[model samples]
Target chain A: MAEGKFTQETVSMTDAQKKAQRSRNIIIALVLAAFVVLLYFGTQAKLGANILQRPL
Target chain B: MSVEAIETKSDDVLISSAMPGDYYRLMKPRVMYLVIFTAFVGMLLAPANINPLLGFIAILCISIGAGASGSLNMWYDADIDAVMDRTAKRPVPTGAVTPDQALSFGIILSVFSVITLGLMVNWLSAFLLAFTIFFYAVIYTMWLKRSTPQNIVIGGAAGAFPPMIGWAAMTGSVTIESIVLFAIIFLWTPPHFWALALFRLKDYENASVPMLPNVAGERSTRNQILGYAVLLALSGILPAVLGFASIYYGVFSAALGARFLWLSFKVWKNGSENEHYGFEKKLFGFSIFYLFAIFAALGTEAVIMRVIG
Candidate 1:
């Protein structure tokens, strides 16, 4: 029973570490994703004339 | 706990050091997503409506195949990835996965993806999938990468094959339009990559991969980037001229191409260390958007036509 508890504690610590790492990853990914979004929409907006074509 | 059990736990830690999520990171899932998205667009535009299930199967297989290639790349390049900040935390390099495990995982994924694609999609796409794996794994990784500075340029062919494979999956034959898609990516790769090579010169040099920056010097690399930018700009016009795409695509391609050319010119004209130009990051990031937008345009046009009909 004590050994089970011990392993449970260890696993919890590992899970905590994993959660911390995931948070870091999400932040970095969001920053990069934001940059990509800006570049994509910014360029599209710049090419407004071509993109706004209505079969002409 | 006994000593043996402790050892076993340590081994477990070594085998999966970074957790399951690391698997996605190591496989370069984002890159695979972009490749699959473009390939899907190609398939959708190919004058047919494939069963959505079958189309999904083909795309998933291609994605897995792309991931398999990435796993193998990480396995082989672990030493270099260990140091490069851009790729340092890959499963193998970070000790989440052993080299042997990664090798086996990659091999298994390779076989599984190809067989699944062949049985679910067309055999032609299956064959192309197999060739892409071989070209990247054996030709690029084993032979050319260490030996030539033109590694990425030649190896770019492996990546450039995806849209063609997608078209073949739908139509069972290659066409001028598909080949032109291949050509645009083929020409764009060097300039896109060389810009990053300029920024990360030391990491590549430390890894001894003989990238253009290390072997040919920044000047030659920049000039090459400029040359490729010009070629890419020209190739961008072919889709519209050939009547495969609309004038809208042509206009957008021209704008994107002009911007790409300007970035290349900046990379060529300014010194590498100069932050005034903001050349390096702009080219690296914009190149990705350039390919995606072009492919996205193709997909959107096809959707518009389908709706109108």
Candidate 2:
């Protein structure tokens, strides 16, 4: 059966695969952080200089 | 086949492992390309200047949301997909990805796309994106697709939403101009898909999907295709009529619309078996070019105006 093709071992990562996976995870995290920072600044720019200033 | 049967099959001891690329394929990248292109054009056409970074983020989120819908569709339709030759090799059907995994991936991406767009862009566009995903995945894929002959006609609206979302990204609300963009795509869809249905009638029949050709007779579908083509031609010129686009664009859109209608007429006239001269096949191929060309013309017009002014 097609299901039998995917044994637990097939899904399990080897040591090299595990190391590569960790590296990819780290890269994804860093990229996500950069996106957040970019979005924050972009929103601020669009909102203008007194974006955070409140009405008295 | 029921969802339960598919899930039960997926719950086997040895689930098929998927590569990263297999997961990517689940998102239907080809369809996503059209969505991204339309949305990008809408963003460009908007009156306001969007910050480049936010604009990129908006497009990224929209693409992800589109991908999420594609994944969910694959998950739900795995049973029929397995049966259809065209889809038998898809990730879920081929055992490259389990239905459960695809479901989780789709759900996660859907939530992520909506939340990120809402936080980074305006809420209105985000809401539209969320609704597009739901409409495609639930309304179209789960319900209308199997139940109705007008599935493409109705469900086509989901595909038509991206440009509006892009316009909303800039303006924070939809406008008549954006709706014109929506209408263009909405009208273009039936003829395009019906042409394809003419050629792939057997695939739909095997899947038991109530496609227009399968439910209504072929002759009726052909007549409907011609009818939609005529309407599409009229709607295609709206941007010029509405004054957002120049006369040059209007002329060009009208020319493309004319050719589209001609192709539809050709498809309706000759239902012959000749492979190379087959009108249905030609129409199907031209329909793709028709949509791309129309959108590209609009984007080009926008660019020229920006440059000259």
lDDT for each residue of candidate 2 in A1-56, tens digit (9 for 90 to 100):
13332233344445544554566466669767986787678678657777888898
Local accuracy of candidate 1 as per-residue lDDT tens digits, B45-145: 78877766677767877888888888888888888889888888778877766688678778988997898677667789999999988898888887888
Could you tell me how far off, in angstroms, the CA of residue B57 lies in candidate 1 after the best superposition?
0.3
Clashing pairs in 2: none
TM-score for each predicted model, relative to the true structure: 0.80, 0.87
Task: Tell me, by DockQ, which candidate is best.
Answer: 2
lDDT of 1 by residue, A1-56 (tens): 00111242243335545564576468659856864564455445434577677684
Chain A TM-score per model, please list them.
0.45, 0.63
Pairs with steric clashes in candidate 1: B17-B96
lDDT of 2 by residue, B98-207 (tens): 89989998999999899889988889999999999999999999999889999989999999999999999989989999999999999988988888887888899999
lDDT of 2: 0.86
Residue B150 local lDDT, model 1: 99
Please tell me how candidate 1 rates in CAPRI terms.
incorrect
Clashes of 1: 1
Number of the top lDDT candidate = 2
